[model samples]
Target: MSAGTAAAGPHALEELLGDPFDPTNPAGYRAAVDADDAGSVADTATRALDRWGAGAEFVPASLGGRFTAVDELARRFRPAFRRDAGLGLGYGLTSLMAALPVWAAGTGAQRDRLAALLAAGRPVPVAFHELGHGNDLSANALSARPTADGWMLDGTKQVINNAERADAVLVLARTRADDGPERAHTLLLVEDLDDLPARGFARLPRYRTTGLAGCRLAGLRFTGCPVPRSATVGTVGHGVPTALAAFQVSRCVTAAASTSLLEAALDAVLRFAGGRELYGRTVADLPHAQSLLAGAYADLHLAQATATTAARALHLHPAGGARIAAAAKYLVPLLVEDALNDLAVVLGARGYLREGEYAIVGKHLRDAAGVSIGHAGGTSCALTVLGQLPGLRPAADPPDPDLFSGRPLPELDLSRLRLTGPRADPLLAVLTDPTGTGSAAGGAAPRTRELLGGLAAAARTIGIRAAALPAARRGVEADHRALALADEYARLVAAASCLGRYAAGRVDGSPGGLPPGWLDAVLRRVVRRRGRHGEPGSATSDSALLAHAAARTTAGLSLDLDPDRVVRHRPHPPRRPHPSRVLTPTAGGTP
Candidate 1:
């Protein structure tokens, strides 16, 4: 089993929610459509997640929760995202993002209290990004002044998810105004929001977003809001490192779980392609349509592979996880967005629908567009990666083989996460080692080795180019050429991850191996994705993969790494009232 399937399995969520294509299932796509139309999410679906005890997936097993592995946590959250991106983000992900830092550095009392709150299914929101300052958390204007009793907070944090309804809030504030910007901020976990307004806090108005519209995207204004000194989540003047580590973890899992959007889009396109006909043949039979569908499937696989590997790196290589997660957050969403658009090519008019059989496709597309810009925008992620690329010389040792073996890993130790990457990138060693014998890879066909040879050569060039750039040209005001090099480096990391997964399959020789030529097809897609910057001679026919996609879709099997049966079209189950409403967490509550 994949590490995640060991814990409750994504199939559990899939089964409980039933077939999304089944128009009448209360917790299915039809309900999702209605909710989106009404500017909210379906209570039935959110409640189904609650019934499944998904909240436990957010807290760690040490803290009496089910989230032992980051990979499993991502998978466990997949079904919710596949059902409704808003449901996944608003109901659970925000809370998890809010709690990770606390788990990483909070005192024993803080950890225990936060765990109890999450266990009881309450949402805990975070405030970090201000409207004026995006990912540059260092420039944040929120200030928490020290006083005898505790600290008094001022300024407003805008565009925060669940800001109004959450019982507690985690705020990243400027704790010290000093020359050392890195140590100027601190994280404060403020609880009991109900009393904050009575003191000096004001809940700000909601901000409407194009995507994730259902989220209560509001803010908090503190005109001397009083929070005890004990509210400090970690050491004083260490918010930068703490938030940086949390960002790595958050970027990894969010990118992994969000790949579900690609899957849902593929499902919609396949459904439309199978039933709709233009000339004399079904759209699925047309060569052009088949090619697009197959390419989209390969992209889906590629996106999932890259995302899952990055998440897995958290356990296997937390010290280097920052760079990989940064790369993923920078590239994977665009890949998914590209794949969605490719499927939309096959989907045509139905891709525009928001309330029909193919409504989920359009909705997922809009929601996915937010993934690239939300939390960490593309520029921030790319810069994070670019700054580290030059230092990514291949490590002397190979990364842990279990990184790709799908084996269970030790519980993710948040303390192990680093604000900076390692002296060398271990995962790159596999891709840069042209000789198959030198890598963690098992024996492969001569042709596969040739492809690796090309990739390795290109990767060396990227590294050299990145290393050549002057330090003056590598900051936030970095030139376009430097950033482009970073983009190329990120793609190579993704391509290397694919090779790692392929190598594991060879050693594993498992029953659930992917379709033949799946590796070649996906590699070429990456090359194609890279355009003029990619390695040569990797492109190959994707016909067989397309046939596999069609067969899998018709058979109700997922077009991902794992070959699990999915709920395809079925007679709609009996319908029940699905009231559309925003998420309502218990406020003014204690953990």
Candidate 2:
């Protein structure tokens, strides 16, 4: 089993929730479409997760909860995200992301208070995104001026999730008047919003969203609101560093969460393709359709490998983690978006529907788009990776095989996270500079070795070109090339991670392991994704892998490194009044 699935082994959430197609539970796929009332739709999932004691999952064992490793944590939360991104965000992820900063720099009292809030199922909103500044944290207009007693905060934060209902707020505000780039903003833990003078604080109206309709994307404005000095997370003017460190961790988890959505989307596509008749047989039997399905399956695993490695770096190699984290955040969403878009073609007209059993597929697509652009977004993450390219050097020692060895992961210490360090990445080093026999991977299949060889060549070429650019020309002229190189490096990391998983028996020669031609299929897709001009190889080999995935998914088996028997799909029973709303019947009999 993968470390993630292994961690979720004893959990009851998956069993109780069952497949999205199940009939008995009203909260399955059928109900998900009908519960589309803007602010109230996500309540069902929120209540379910609360009942499951999911709050405990967000806290660390040392803090009196069950979080052990970042990878395992992502696995535990994937189900919620797969069901509804809105539910994941409004219900938990927002709060979890907010909690990370506190965990990283908070005092013991602050940590204790935050833990208590989580255990009580209280949502803590992180107000880092100022719509006015557009994710430019340093440019935020929200100001906190020191007073005789504490600080008087003024200014507004927009597009914050769960802003109105959160028990406490984590505010990123400017503390210094000087416009200097460093140490201008400070992070404060604002508590007891109810105690704020009614005249000083106000909640703005929630913004309607094109996606995540269930989320309350609202704003908050503070006018000289008083906050205690004890609310300060770390030292004065250190908020920028604290937030960046937290982003490195949260972004990796966010990427991992996106994979779950990809799996669900693929599940929907395979079901449609396997049952629908195209020519003489099921659409899945068609060569082109099968090719699409297998490519997507390979893509999902490749993204998972990269994301899982980045999560592992939280503890194993925290120093070089910033670049890895940015790469995951930048790559996973775009990949899953492509995967979903491909499936949309397979679904044909079904992809356009807004309500029905399969309508959740459309919702998943829209929600996935919002996630990529939300928070750090794709552009921000790409720039972060690009900025690091100029300073990167191959690691002095090769990356440890234990990182992707697919063994049980070690517990992480978030306090060790850094904002900046040497750009030497051991993971990419394994690809760029190979030791004789490739440590622990000496016995890997020849095809797998070929993948490593291709990856090494790509890295060497990218390195030479990236280094050749003068530092002046490297800024804007190199944007396209740098972004392409970042993507190539990410693919190499994914390939290495897959090889490691195979060596440790996580892939274990199963069909899920990119067996033989599957690896070639993945590399071709990667090269094409990088906009490279190359011969498009035959899909004959990948067709078998796609067929395997379709059969397994049809039987309700998971597509991760660890395969498990899953609850088979049960057709939705007749629709009842949505627990949230009573919709008038349409001209058709549906809903």
Best by lDDT: 1
Cα deviation of 45 in candidate 2 (Å)?
2.4
Q: Residues 286-401, candidate 2: write the lDDT tens digits.
A: 66677677767877877787788888887788887887888888888877888787777777788899765568788888888877776798767766666666656667776666
After superposition on all CA atoms, how large is the RMSD of candidate 2?
A: 6.6
The residue ranges of model 1 lying beyond 4 angstroms of the native Cα positions read 1-7, 197-199, 434-450, 506-511, 530-540, 570-591
Give all TM-scores, in the order shown. 0.91, 0.89
lDDT of 1 by residue, 1-591 (tens): 121333566778788888888778988888987887777888888887776777778878877778888877887777888888888988888888899999989999999888877777789998989888778888998999999989999899998888878888899999899748889999999988887666698888988877777777898899978899999988999998888898887897788767888887787777677666454456776677777777777777777788888888889888889988999888888788877877777777777777788888888888897766768988889998888877457766667888888888778998888878775787777687645324422344566556677777776566667778998777888989989877877777778788887767542313245765666666777865554222222223555666566666556677666656677663332233234432223464211
Model 1 weakest 10-residue run by lDDT: 531-540
Q: Candidate 2 — which pairs collide?
A: none
- The positional error of residue 544 in candidate 2, measured at the CA in angstroms, is 2.1
* Model 2: residues with Cα > 4 Å off, grouped in runs: 1-11, 37-42, 433-451, 461-464, 470-478, 509-516, 530-537, 554-556, 563-565, 570-591
Error of 2 at 579 (Å): 44
What TM-score quantifies how close candidate 2 is to the native fold?
A: 0.89
